[model samples]
Target: MRTYLDYNATAPLRPEARAAMIAAMDVVGNPSSVHAEGRAALGIVQTARARVAAAVGCQEAEVVFTSGATEAAGVLDGFGDVQVAPTAHDALWAHHRRSEKGASIYAMGVANSETGILSDLPKRDEAGWHAPEGTADFLMLDVTQALGRIPFAFSWSGADLAVCSAHKLGGPKGVGALILRRGLDVEPLSLGGGQEMGRRSGTENVIGIAGFGAAVEAAMRDLAEGQWQRVEKLRNILETSLEARANKTIFVGKAESRLPNTSCFITAGWKGETQVMQMDLAGFAISAGSACSSGKVRESRVLRAMGFDASQAASAVRVSLGPETTEDEVLRFVQAWLGKEEKFRARSAA
Candidate 1:
């Protein structure tokens, strides 16, 4: 049987989410229409918005639905001075603009997607910008990878805006949200009917939003029940088992605050792409790094930013678990990796 373990890329769709989406398919009305059918669609959108707001610890009005995290970050496009964290995702990175004057807006990911390294939201003073009117000092945050995997609250995060994708939390892939603190405003990314309170315009994706809401509800329940703790234990087990046999392997962010389910490790001289292919052939799916790079496996920029040399950077493979992962799967992956390690060692010796 095939074992899928690439959660950092995208999670398997949750059954609750699937059912919600299927149910939403029957709601045949545009959210913007004023007719009864349209109003029904509008109600569905509002319900999903409230669910997302609940999960994010923000007000429903603060949440603006978007195509996904990439489009959610479009609010950043209207900003003038932007400073991106070194480890931020490419979407956030694309908005970076260096200015002679200090930056007023900063973009960052709450956690590093590739390495699972957690980053605390910087305070206003630390960011070198004062919160004018107690709002808009801090800019956007990418919560795509951290949303379901960690305890994060946009209401307390200090950032004025946060972007989250649905697929990261076992929802439909196309829908996501931008959480905007009240009283803060930005130019509309797409201007038309102003469906998302004049922030995002156009008809809503009812089915995807329904799925996202259902997935967020499930994720919140799992978090409250401490289900991720079990996944954390599995991650540790995989690391411990691998470390025992692969003495030369280096586990990234092992001693730091990271996502509990993620383990990024490097075995020098063995390219991550090769390991991923071999593991895939062995019925286990993993990733060389972020799945966002158009499937091109390259040296991890996050590793290089953290001062890893090119060799080690290029050799990192990430195994991210989920609530559904079991002990058997983790151990099986460890065994397969160990076998691969031995072959690499033998070849190097020969």
Candidate 2:
């Protein structure tokens, strides 16, 4: 049986989301229409907005649905200069780097997609002139990777704007949201018959929105039940098992607070891509850094920012678990990975 240890890339769709999407397929009116059918469609969107707001601990009016986190991050493009942590997701980092100098906006991720490192965002009062508490625009947090996996709230995140993808939290792909504090606004990226309260324009994705709502509800239930704690234990077991056999391996972010299901480790001599292929052939799914950068062969900028050399950064692989991941699956992956590591060691010695 193949074991899937790459949940960070994208989590499997939840049954609740699937069911919601299926039900939404039967709705036949555009949310913009004023007719009864249209009203029904609009109701679906509003309910989803409420659910998403509840999930992120924000007012429903503050949520603006978008195509995905990438498009959601575009809402920050109109801001003046933006400073970003190297650990941010590519979407946010790309826009941040393009902004003018003397950054007034601090944009970064709450949790790194590759290393799973959690960031301690500066408090509103402690942050300088452009603090979130002030009238000027301040922080933009990319909470895509942290949403369902950890507790988060737009009200308490000390960010003027926050972006996240539904797919990251067991909802359907191609749908996300941008959360803004009341009274703050962004220039619309899409211009159309005004939708998403004119913050994001275009027809609301009724089906996707419904699924997102269902997924958030389901994820919250899992969190409340403490299912992730079990996954965390399994993650520890995998790391401990591998560390006992591979003394030279370096575990990234091991000393820091990270997502419960993620582990990033490096073996200086072995390329991460090679290990990914080896693991795939061994009936396991893994990744060499962010899924967005998997096709490229380069060092991780996140690791480099943490002061690792190019070689060490290039040697990292990430294993992310999900609530469904089992101990047997993790143990099997450990054994297969150890066998491959042993072979690489032998070759290096020879």
TM values, all candidates: 0.95, 0.95
Model 2 lDDT, full chain set: 0.85
lDDT values, one for every candidate: 0.87, 0.85
lDDT at 82, model 2: 64
Taking the tens digit of each residue's C-alpha lDDT, what string does model 2 give over 1-350? 88888888889999999999999999999999999999999999999999989988899999999988899888767777766767788888887544444436778889998988898886555545343323233788888888877889888775788888899889999999999888975688788877888888889899999999999889888888988888889989999999999999999888899999999999996988888989999999999963455377577888888888888888899999998898999988998999999999999999
Please give the lDDT score at residue 194 for candidate 1.
72
List residue ranges in candidate 2 displaced over 4 A.
98-103, 126-137
Candidate 2 minimal-lDDT segment of 10 residues: 128-137
Model 1, range 96-172, lDDT digits (tens) per residue?
Answer: 77554533577888899899999866656653544222323466789899887788888877668899999998998
Cα distance off (Å), candidate 2, residue 172: 0.9
- Give per-candidate clash totals: 0, 0
> Candidate 2: deviation at residue 70, Å?
0.7
lDDT of model 1 at residue 89? 91
